[model samples]
Target: MTCFPVVCEVESVMLEMQDPKTGVKSQPQRLVITTIPHAITGEDIVAWLTNCYSIEAEEAWALGTMLVAFGYIYPLQDHKRLVIKPDASLYRFQTPYFWPAQQWPVEDTDYAIYLAKRNIRKKGTLELYEQVQYNSLHKWMNHKWDFIVMQAKEQYRAGKERKKPDRVVFDCQERAYWVVHRPPPGTVSAMDYGLERMVDPNTEELLFSCLFSLFSSLVKYSVTYNKHDPFLAPCLPSNPWVTDDVTYWLLNMANVEIPTKMRVERWTFSFGELLSDPRGRDDFRLFLKKEFSGENLAFWEACEDLKWGTAATMNDKAQQVYKTFLTRGAPRWINIDGKTMEVTVKGLKHPHRYVLDAAQTHIFMLMKKDSFGRYLKSPVFKDTQKRAILTTVENAQSKMGIIILKRRPSISPIIVRQLEQEERARMATSGPVDITQVMSKLSNKGKEVPPSKK
Candidate 1:
């Protein structure tokens, strides 16, 4: 469960010595405890708490403040600090594979030994299974969840391996992960692309569920410590409030149609596909144009072309691309954050291929989260998909014909007895003579002619 910091106000009243001297005189000292909350202006947390717990509270704060506070619920941060981006040094357990873990600094066996020692020290046991499981799952979730998908048509593409690529990718700009693999080798009867269309609160909830599950498993393997029997076995959170609200808010922000897939042999598609395909690119551009953000994709594509072009082309167009997209006053300037724009501009004096990486990544991601979802849902894409499906159905029906010829009758019990008898008679007349008769004929001919030859 996630934790969040909370603030509350407390009040105390004190009796002074003046009351003792008078034997009846009481001096009340109001002690105020500092804290805060949302409600009608000046309503402060103190009054809300008072009203919630005790009696009808009179409003002390101004009317404007009260209006601002009314019905404004605090947000949830249920996934706080769950995104564990460890530094290079601590990546000792996961630096081996280049497919999922991009960077490598050590050999596989060496890393295994390092993990063993590390786990034994920390967990008091040599069981590193959970660690590796989480390491892989976290890598998969953070990296590959977005890019992987299986298209039904790719199964028939000749020379395309039936095997899926063993890779996972986390596109930072897209804010999604994907696991790519080949679709199962067969004609797909029907396909359902259950693409995530909205932020899944359940994912965040499930993540904590898994975390607590792993934590419980780890505790089972723990050993006793000196002067204590280790500690009580860790248990799962019992209360919903145990989770942090800030994380949930952040996750909601991240997960919302941020153009978010994986598993069962996912297909990895390239942004180049988006840029190169005439129909696709034009459709996407049109969607962005409608949104008045067409320049973002245009700028991104230009940077990509410049980055991949020849050295001479890069040198010629680098300044133009930079000025057009990165500069503040330039025409068709994109809406990248200031930092990315500044970095891109700074590097324009002597531009290289990677100069626009930061800015391009930002724009690419901006389009992905901001416009990509809408593009998928746009009438253009829907109509295109509908047309494609209709075309496929037409082609299939035309090729196969309306009346499908079957090898057998529709009724299992119905039989043509006359046809069966005629087939048997035909086979009897046309089939080869028995092997016994052929051998007897040869024997008789040999007996009749061989006596004189001897």
Candidate 2:
């Protein structure tokens, strides 16, 4: 007779009994079971049952089911776990075959299109969304959105929590934007590079409005004249830097003081530095307004804001932006040059997300060359500069009080002479003097001398 020792701990015991009416009785059998250790796998337990217990295949299977039900064993989810010996063919960077199947499972790609569409719709990528929705999945279809979905799905299937996008789809309404190509892994799309996304929506809207007002006037000027001037300068008087509810609302949202610290010293900063500080940029906009060329700065800033705004609001913002800044006579127009303006205006008819690139670039260059230098020399800016320096001096003085030596109350002649005598006496004696004898002599002399009463 052969004996097999079961290597398992008993988890639970149950008694079998008979049903009264049907008279069906079950045997009260003692079932001795084994529990799998945490470190051991289901296959290991099965092998243990076969080798140690020497059980028949059927009995081993029966025990296997019970072990699995008791949470004592589990099947490996990673297909690679089955491969005892991994070879070069087992793992490849492009594609690997852990299973016997010659082809790796083509991850269900049907949702790729739908997910891309939904993402485009969510992000306001109208051209891409429409392309994916109406057209076949081709090279032109925005692969970046599809890639994001694939990565997200892969992460989820791998037991990682799904990731959400932290960036906005579009930061500016005026600029037409589209994803041209799929970005490499670990890099942002080309459209997103060097663009601001996180901005106050109200500020974005106000900037759009300002640009619209400027461009609308330009378009009106263009239609009346047959020969549109390429280098038309703004001749209008400067508009006061308007502070309506929008400005206050945005400030409150940011929890920052108005015309922030940077705004006060706008004249001293370069255009690049001004771009980083919203308040400084705003002050520069006021200078541009004074020059009657505020539209250039407004359009550029609006584009930046929209570029960095949440990705979801891009489409509608883009449309409104196009109508306002690019379209002829649209409200709050950015007065771009004729050739560029015409190109932008035509592009607006079939606006893709990046259609405003030429115009934005033109305006950026225009502002950098023209308004920036003049801004430094502008009377308003110079005045502000003077006030800034004065304010700085005053603030410093207040923070750190000035110390002045009051003319030492002129020392009395007698006290000065006594102090000199004391200094000489101290210098002459190296050892300690007997003060008791000196004091007695002085008192005796004082008593002998007649006292002069004043």
Compare the candidates by lDDT and give the number of the best one.
2
Clashes of each: 27, 30
User: 211-305 in candidate 1: lDDT tens per residue?
Assistant: 88999876654432211121342111111133222322332232232221110001113344455444466667766787788888888778778
lDDT, candidate 2, residue 78? 24
Q: Write the per-residue lDDT of candidate 2 for residues 67-185, one digit (tens) a residue.
A: 33222222222221222111111111101121111222323243344344344445744344444543444344342333334443443344323222101101110011111122223
Misplaced by over 4 Å in model 2 are 1-269, 342-353, 389-454
* TM-scores for every candidate against the unseen true structure: 0.31, 0.30
For candidate 2, what is the TM-score?
0.30
lDDT of 1: 0.40
